[model samples]
Target: MSDRQAYSGMAVTGIDAKGRAAIPAFLRAALDRNGAESRVIIAESANAPCLIGFDPAYLEANRAKYGSRADARLDAGETVDANAARLAFALNDIASYDSSGRFVLPPFPAMKAGLDKTGPVLFAGLGDTFEIWNPELLEADAKVHPAFKERALFCLSQWKKGGKG
Candidate 1:
């Protein structure tokens, strides 16, 4: 329910010959600052044609928020934690970073984004989460999705409206 720290601006890196893609140092630094270097979850969502990376902090935050919501409607006799667990596991297929700082992408994401044992991938900074996209796909998505423009305009309008006007 609260705003997460804004972490943006990153460059690209290639997956090594051995399929190890180094996450951006800046991004990694951000995660480290947030105490999220130990583990990270990589998954894919349809909204973006890229691999989505989530830190434990963000995931745990989400889990807690959803858990609280679930708790509000728990059966008096039944366990309140059950609903929380169910909601938490809904997006549980998260991949974690290895000792060498790499988490393999899920099959669906790897195939969809065409990420395999060769070439580079774009790692974008998305504040609370990070996205790994194929360069082509990232470009294509940018053209079609007006989210950035819309968000900019929305922010400008909000500023003009005097913070709540």
Candidate 2:
């Protein structure tokens, strides 16, 4: 149950009208391997137009790393906006899933990621964290990997056909 366990793989699931979606079994296994609780932290990705999900342990590690960097900057006589740092880290929202891996998406973060109430949500694993994407948005993103875009397109087709995706 090391916190170093990595997340890998992709899954597509639907978000109901209540914004509830299931975490794919593969990603859930990775979280379990890391000794994570049923809760996960969801946040908007700074580098992409998607939401990122990770365990609390990883969130703490990120906070510690950012704190160290800010301290270093302060020690170097550089100006650091304490307020901005807090706000930046405050973007994360905690979500608790049931044993079946179903959880309600936080509205703000979901909306920020362009996720609608009902549609296919693609969960793509990225080692330390996973990305939650709106399949259509992902398919239209030119900066996304070709393979990912392809997968998104496939998911979109399945969703349109009334499949689980």
Candidate 3:
């Protein structure tokens, strides 16, 4: 297998009343450049209040490992596809952006998470998955768990210091 790739920085966004959020133009451009704009997966995270997004490439890897082998007999192996599918479909909703560069989140969960309208959200890029966070929730999480800031800052500083290539 090939080595995993590193993802870029977190993009900050603002949610509108209509549950529409505008992703960063640079990110959109990057996705376009990488040919990943049209296919992406969005789902709720296991440990955070944030919603997570995954590129199709990443999802396929996941499928190959855990989602693609369900048809085998139970004696042979178990498939996590059903649960993964439920989690992805129920908690995480996949979306595609229109030409205008807007994605409308489902209103129920957005409202439940206080992402209802006019809130800042953080979009963090993970290799195969990206996470969305309400800015305040992120801030609160940082406050409660100082390691996040410590680790993030340490990593950021490493990049700044040319410690990372």
Which predicted model would earn the best TM-score? 2
- Give one clash count per candidate, in the order shown: 0, 0, 1
State the lDDT of candidate 2 residue by residue for 1-165, as single tens digits.
253778887778889899999998889987777767898889898888899999888878878888898899989999888786666678889999889899999999899888857878999889999999987778778899897788767866776787755
Worst 10 residues of 3 by lDDT: 156-165
The C-alpha stretches of model 3 lying farther than 4 A from their native spots are 1-6, 37-39, 68-81, 88-90, 142-165
Instruction: Tell me the tens digit of each residue's lDDT in model 3 across 23-125.
Output: 5555555555545656456666777777776556666666576533554535476534466566645565567876655788766566655577775666666
Q: Where is model 1 more than 4 Å wrong at Cα?
A: 1-5, 73-103, 142-165
Q: What TM-score does each of the candidates earn?
A: 0.66, 0.89, 0.67
lDDT of 1: 0.63
- State the C-alpha lDDT per candidate: 0.63, 0.85, 0.60
TM-score of 1: 0.66
- lDDT of model 2 at position 145: 85
Candidate 3 to native Cα RMSD, angstroms: 6.4
Candidate 3 contains a number of clashing pairs equal to 1
Candidate number of the best lDDT? 2
